[model samples]
Target: MAHALIRRTLHAAAAAVVAATGLVAAGATTATPARAAVTCGVLFDDFSYASASDPALAQRGWHIRTSAGGPGVPGATWSAGNVSFPTVDGQTVARLQATTNGTGAGTTHAEMSLPDRRFFEGTYFARIKFADTPVSGNDGDLVNQTFYTISPLRYAMDPIYSELDFSEYLPNGGWGATGPTNFQTTWYTYQPDPWVQDRQYSSQSRSIAGWRDVMATVSGGEVRYYIDGQLVGTHGGKFYPRQNMSIDFNQWFIDLTGHSGGTSVWHENVDYVFHAKKQVLTPAQATARVNAFRAAGTRHTDNVTADNSCTPAETPPPAGGTTRIASNWNNKCIDVPNWNFADRQRVHVWDCTDGTNQKWQFVDGTVRTENNKCLDVADAATHDGAAVQIYTCNGTAAQQFVLSAAGDLVNPQAGKCVDIAEWNPDNGAVLHLWTCVGGANQKWRRA
Candidate 1:
């Protein structure tokens, strides 16, 4: 499990917003490019009857816990969302449709239970496309809900779990009091405790329509939310442990009650692509992977498929500099020359001349300018064309970093980590964040 930094009330609101968006903001620095070594692990693996029997789930360290409301009782025909084993494309797909209520709409929920007890921090992306709607109430009358869930129970709501709802919709402009398109990314301490909600966590108060890709990451003591390729919000610092959480994809009715009775919502197809790389990633690297996976459709798959090959990246910290920034981040902090806030503001580690840009802080896990802003990947590009820039602080995970025991710096957002440019053993070369492997590029030495 990752260590939780000390909690502070002063930055709670701001940090919560960051936790909601998933992507971290830009800061003063050179945007680290995505290295080939950093790749995905187990991109799409659905454990349904098609791939394996329900019993086999336990053998693979997964359990079919219960549903949201409860187990299917007598007269209740619960559908075990259909699953298809992986093909050459390497994808485990699961499909489920909700039952309609009197209003012709229904809600469905599915979950996956994990076996071992471990604390892991990573990102998840889900692709979704909804079916037709017959505008019962009025025009633009859409009713559907989709969510990515995490449960602590072996089945059902035996023990309540946490949830990251991408889009929760209903007829007549959303389910009763529920908001439209806007989602609630919450954390539940226990079954009794009410879920802590962050409503403004999203970058906008709108719904993601058509085929949309949403990403989320949890690291250290922080949890961040992202949409498409942009950073959104962040939450949870020093609150919960990084436990071994299972992955779940669910679509349910907007109004379980008879608000919009008997309306069935069919999600034609869903693609939840995951890459479990053991290394940390820079925002640029993570965005690149997301875009690539988005373009690749649901057929792409790879975990540990990339070359573990890496190069040295860190330089020894100056004498007496005991402070560790991030294990993969070079301790060198250069002064930001007196430059205007142009479109591109590449940050560099120079002699700690104590300039405005040189000052840095690890706020809620994300690396931030002492001025309280985040270092950003200008224009969200994967190619070398992208430049590193600084922008207003947003608590997306992309800005978060960690210092490993080996003095290596890691970015939980990208899954790929930081690395030294080369083994020149000199200070002039630039330090960049790249795909992670156990290489000198991922190691650092503080003076």
Candidate 2:
């Protein structure tokens, strides 16, 4: 996000001041309003590459940072050499090794950042290992093991300028603080000048002792933070990022005037990093999805792209909900005729099977089929016995029906309930509307 500015030599005193006051605590604020948002499927990476030279990582928008000059006068030297891909637990993970020889702020910091910045308001995930205590002899150093997101630092006033820090670990304390305090922060910037800083942010505190799964979902006007499948905090306000951001990870010292510097190759491992635009899945669902991809031997994919046209988030995908509407009168399930895909097909009553074909979603003002079509009052007729048919969805009242308290799917326009022809219960019976009859045949069940 702000790699160019963050890795370059800047005002150390100002940067230290920003890190001190800016990262002191966590809180919430009022969220700002915006237009509707869009969504796509996913972009995933398992970090299966063996080195930075691997084209896979580059093809997937990955760039290892090895520039200088940042929070410290010369932020830990970004070194591609310190980046590695080592086998861990039978899988290859991106290994970032940070080393310093107690010199000035001249430590070697391993970091990588993605190039995509259109990832606003969606689910994100990362499996990481914050080795606070070095594997070898390094320990007690105030190192920061981080995973974050940032927008182009064009200018603080740039509407797209935003940042979200999922994990910023200070193992040996930072700026008058103690060891082992992890942070999750959301940011909005305000610049009084170029060198000096005045940015606003909300944050949450956490303690990470080992490998942990981190995730966040930015939707419904809020940003939700989670660690290891547990809710951590929610941030919403005028600060909600105005645009997409690049994902990043780095491990470096806090640069407390060299007091926090130390030697010994310390490392942070990343098993994977994933993103699903506008799709909010449970931690279990996310893990399962990732596991499935791994089991299928998938290393990376960019198939999921930005959907510029905003589409309102609807109910879960057709196959995800636990809803099957059954016809009580027929004691059977209401399914599409012959499992056909043709529009205007009369819905039929079939022997109860509790299958996906019988599934229905009553969203907004319409009862929709699993196929993204709508149950319609044929030809927009408002007669008592108007024909009922399946049709391509068009957000129209003609396709809307309410689940009445009387247990009837009543088309309010015609004031009639969906019923089987002649009160028949045989399989393949066509459906139509009739005067509300509070009887078994007139009733439906969401079983």
Whole-model lDDT per candidate:
0.40, 0.65
RMSD of 2: 13.2
Query: Candidate 2's residue-wise lDDT over 274-337, tens digit each?
Result: 8766667788777876764565355764433344332322333333344666876657877887
Q: Model 1, range 324-388, lDDT digits (tens) per residue?
A: 23223444543334533333455444454445555554332334554545565544443322334
Q: TM-scores across all candidates? A: 0.44, 0.61
Off by more than 4 A, model 2: 1-39, 72-75, 156-159, 190-206, 256-262, 307-447
Inter-residue clash pairs, candidate 2: 7-69, 8-69, 8-70, 9-69, 26-203, 30-237, 31-237, 66-78, 329-440, 329-441
Best by TM-score: 2
Model 1, CA-based lDDT: 0.40
Off by over 4 Å in 1: 1-76, 81-93, 103-119, 130-144, 153-179, 190-204, 238-242, 257-263, 277-284, 290-447
